[model samples]
Target chain A: MRSVALQKGLAIAVPALVFGFLVAAQWATLAAPGSRDVGIRYIDPLTASLGRLQDEQTSLKAQLADVRAKLDQLQRAGAAQNGTVRDLSAQLDDLKRRAGLTDASGEGVVVTLDATRAAADLTQDRLPCFAPDLTDIVNAAWRGGARAVAIDGERIVASSSVYCVGGTIVVNGSIVSAPFTVTAVGPTSSILAVVDDPSQLSDLKRRRDQQVVDLRIASVPAVTLPAYGGPVVVRSATPQ
Target chain B: MRSRVGGAAVAAVALLLGVLVVSQFRSRDVYSRSLEQETPESLTTLIADLNDRNRQLREEIFDLQLRVDRAQSQVSGGQGTLEESQRQLEQLEVFSAQSRVTGPGISIRVDGPFDDHALSDLVNELRNAGAEAIAVNDARVGPRSWFAAGANGDLVVDGTGVRGPWTVRSIGASDVLYVAMTRTGGIVGQFQLIYQRTRFTVTRENALDLPPLAAQ
Candidate 1:
């Protein structure tokens, strides 16, 4: 009986020893860097790296803003002490308005241009909407005496470019999509009348008639156009 | 005596076995947490986000230089008034995140894959929910911020690459924002419909800081 017990003990102990050794070896492999195990991987380094880069970028931008604010303050102080500079400053304000550098608010018409759901449902050769459609509407609004205009809240400036990039509209380096809401700050009736004008609405009406796009024009009591966010690209062409 | 010796050896082996097993388990845990292969879609999103950010930064820097030039040219009587107006405008812009802003806010953590449009929609929801200011993983979402497919086809905000789990912070009524985000058919609810496995959480704090466009 004692001999039998010993045999059983040996059987259990030997297998246990082997299992432990196997576990140890597996542990070593898993602990090693670049191990093939799927479960052992940590955070994606690309994500981490990108996060770090963005952090640096944010810090730098804040610093730049601070510096600009200080410099602006100094220049303003200098202007306060000078005579000709004050006149120039007043002119600058007007220029800023014309350039769309400042925000504006007034009675205007809000025009919404959206791709028709039907157009999206059906496969077609030509797109239901185009950048020119937006451009044309903007031109019409201006013709109707719009002092300020904005597309999806992005103020349209002299240097602002409206073009198509793969079905999406690029406005001032930003991508604006269908259901574009164009707000014009001016005489509400005139703005609405301009959009309603047959000649001005010819292309938009045609698109609507062809079931290519949907248009909505409404007069609002008050509309605030955001300041233009894009850079003043022109450096040399000074009032010529 | 022989029985005693055999029992001692067995106990020693058992202890060694336990240690090895425990070590293996720990190592496996560590290994799984260290590295992961990103899907091509996610990689694309990251690259696109980076490119978009670079473009935005470049444009912003150009704008800043123009402003500085305008400021430098200012030399007269209304100069003080101009300065005051400018100072006020800068403050307003900072508040609007036209410039960078830092203040108290709430943070929402989202995990797993998400669509670019959905993220933008989520931000919109937050705004509707009364969030005064918002940021995603430190990226500020201003008026011009957009969510689009990158060159590699990943979702990016403005130019910042979005990856799960995204941390979103908003300065507003924390409770309102939380309820709005987690409400049924709201942003969080909508996100769940698309990604069942995704995790969404919101934490309100007295002070949540957000950087400006550049730092965010």
Candidate 2:
């Protein structure tokens, strides 16, 4: 009877211990770096919350536009002094000078850059929503001193991402389909220098000449930039 | 005899517990090891290094994909395609977008002696007032970021902690955002109405990048 009891204890304890060990190992694996269940894997914020947000933005913009239009009409009727926000030329010029672009207008050239690769493989870099090539020209243009700059029609702002999603330039809040024209209000000379710098290895052009995504520049004194509307989204450093 | 055995077993259990406790104190576990990685620069450098390496790997993948079309591309033939690709990719990576426009807007640096809660409240007010992107030092304040006061009195908006003179850049009608932030029933005024005193540096710039609303 004692032997039988001892044998039963051994069988139960041994299997229980083994099962416990396996469970622990599985937990550890799941919690490991680059883990399957780590929850660190990214989810697209756009599709996740964007649809709802866009609807909200649309309504807000419509209301704001309505209010502004009414106010403008009222002012035109001489109800009060002009309350329109003045153009940001001085600020634009300063930022332009800092960015190395000069302003232009009237039948100027528009340069476009597109990713040579397909979108399937294009993923977000450490800084989300930014592509390497896009950063280069924007920076070069800024360093080249671009005046008023726009990606598509959305005015390129501080922290604006020149990113690729499946092969399109996702600038501002809109999809800027390829031939990403970065229109800058600046001197054509500086814009050309940026696209054709010998020291920068004339990199933008290599892409341009290869007909991969490259820079094209033209000078115009009257290139009109559409006004930016909607809620302003501010981004800062990533949360630790 | 039973009592004697029981006492001995208890003594053994206690001794084992003591040994485990001592071992635990001596062991360099996750928390202790992570201490080295806790430094600000370590994390930022780690992030930057990872970005560069990731970029390198990406360019390689792109090249490989292109090579798939041809029987033999330079990548496998010791063409050193990787290095050339990095050269092309490097110049563009450094100038991460900050402000790419010529504009007049506001630079409302909202950080002060308040705790993280207060700082978050202030920031949210600015956003609700139509403020654009806000960068606290290196950290970008998106929905993913959490604002908290660190062990050091610095108000960390994102992973990056900031203190006085914490610059908040917004590309909207600055005056409106400014008034709303400080207006009664607003964040700044609410805190002031409650605490009676709060100090911060708020300036308005005519131009600031309201980057596509942080991709919604």
Candidate 3:
């Protein structure tokens, strides 16, 4: 009788357990589709999200580079537009001269004069005329009307000089052997008048009387003034 | 046999359902591999294409950098030229203004009655006489060139080379300059060359041309 009761209990328990398992499995199947674990199928959602972030970073960097390039272009354009701050003619001429592009030679009148010492030109038994004689010659030249003038093939600016001490004549602060020729561009009448001045006459007379150095004057109608070709050193001058 | 066959058919259907259920559960596996299909091929293609584009861009950048550098140097040189030209023009203008004169003027030339010493003394007198702008020989009448005597007997004044005709011509009021030139120690009185007839003549004239002004 105990064996039959045991057999009866197992038969009933076995069928009931099977039915419960079926119902549980059906519920599990319905829930499995909507779970977070579904994200693992086909592609790992986390890895995909990481890949998207990397792509975004790359895109952002490219944008930044583009912006930087645009900014640089704009700055360069602004600098190019800066206006000239000085007079153009002066600027061009100076630049040209520095580059050895000067057009400062032409047909002009040439003046030649010499200095000789004598007794009458002296004062207190001493030589009274000095470098001032040179001054007289240049002034006369200007009065004669010269556009561009030079001494011994060297262009003379406002800063050029003539220093005479003892027996030396310095031109532009440099000693040069001379039968010095001063050239100018203008009509011959004014040039002749300049040559016929009184101071020049006196210097000639003194040279003849005392036989100081040597005195002579010659006026040339056609003389080609050569452009000065030397070191093109330049310094800025204080503006007036 | 027929009953056994029916039982087998049902068992087969149940087995199929069990397999389907297991497959569904496998699809929801949390421990799935991170690897994806065709990963290497896609990455390789992307890398190769990007590298090509990058190389082209780098070449362009290098060329542009060179061009920009050259342009910069050119601009710098141009600016320097502009500045130098301006300087020359200003110097010319100053000269033009100081030398312009219109009217009766006096011309005085004194190189030396006897020697360079006589010329120097006359120079002192000329300065005392209020002479303006002097030069000797081919040299100019600058602070350094003043009193610079010509080795070949030439005297420069105001950049004009004067030899014997040490002409000093004044515009307008040369009388004052002349008066000052002839002071007791001036060339008019003390210069030995004047006494020796070293050629000293002072006269008033409407015009005169000792020489051309030096041009630099």
Pick the DockQ winner.
1
When 1 and 3 are scored with lDDT, the better candidate is 1
lDDT of 1 by residue, B123-156 (tens): 6556545455678887876534545444444467
| Reference-based lDDT, residue B158, model 2 | 36
RMSD of 2: 23.6
Where in model 2 is the C-alpha error above 4 Å? A1-64, A72-109, A116-130, A165-168, A200-203, A207-215, A233-240, B1-216
Write down the worst ten-residue block by lDDT for model 3 chain A. A230-239
Per-candidate TM equals 0.43, 0.33, 0.34
lDDT for B50 in candidate 1 is: 44
Chain A TM-score (model 2): 0.49
Candidates 1 and 2, the one with greater lDDT: 1
Model 1 Cα lDDT, one tens digit per residue, A1-240: 989887868776777677777766666555443344355223365547655655655554555555445654655576667655456556555546655767799899988877654454342223333666776677667657788888887676533546543344556545455578888898888767868977666868987778567677899998788766543332111110
Residue by residue across A107-132, what tens digits does model 2's lDDT show? 33355654332121121121112244
Best by TM-score: 1
Which regions of candidate 3 deviate over 4 angstroms?
Answer: A1-87, A90-107, A115-130, A198-201, A205-214, A227-237, B1-72, B76-216
DockQ of each two-chain model: 0.05, 0.02, 0.02
